[model samples]
Target: MHSLNDLLESFHLYAECERCQRSMQLSVEKLIARLGNDFPVTDLRPRLRCTGCNIRGQDLRIVFVGPPGKRMVFQYRR
Candidate 1:
């Protein structure tokens, strides 16, 4: 498995609020800008917050959206 830093650096993160089900996409640059370069990846959950519902990071579902694999297209439909 990739390390948190590796995942964050190479992929976009999808954060969803558990309470409101609102979601947002975060880039590595934005995360670094918000949390700083020294922030620990394991500690990210406590630092996230839902903009719509004001939910805490601990209550959010965070998914890593990585690059497309072989035989996969760039577009995502769901």
Candidate 2:
């Protein structure tokens, strides 16, 4: 199954350099933990903008899938 974390692994926005293979897979695991194992997130969106710049560059987008194919985005609220 294609997990959100798997998608994140390929994202370059979080990469410090070209040689680094983004291994922040735990973000997916933690998000799942918060949602509970019973709940499964299926998809994630494109890379979002960075804090330093308004550019929608490399970043993680987690799409928490719910019942009946519903989708909820996980992001920090200010």
lDDT of 2 by residue, 1-78 (tens): 544444333322121112232323235455555655444333222233334444433334333333334444443211
Each model's backbone clash number = 0, 1
By TM-score, how accurate is candidate 2? Answer: 0.26
Candidate 2 weakest lDDT stretch, 10 residues: 10-19
lDDT tens digits, residues 1-78, model 1?
A: 333456453355566676788877766676677767666655676777888877677343334444446232233211
What CA RMSD would you report for each candidate? Answer: 5.3, 12.2
Candidate 2 has an lDDT of: 0.36
Candidate 1, superposed: residue stretches over 4 Å from native: 1-4, 58-78
Candidate 1 lands at a TM-score of 0.58
| Candidate lDDT (C-alpha), each | 0.57, 0.36
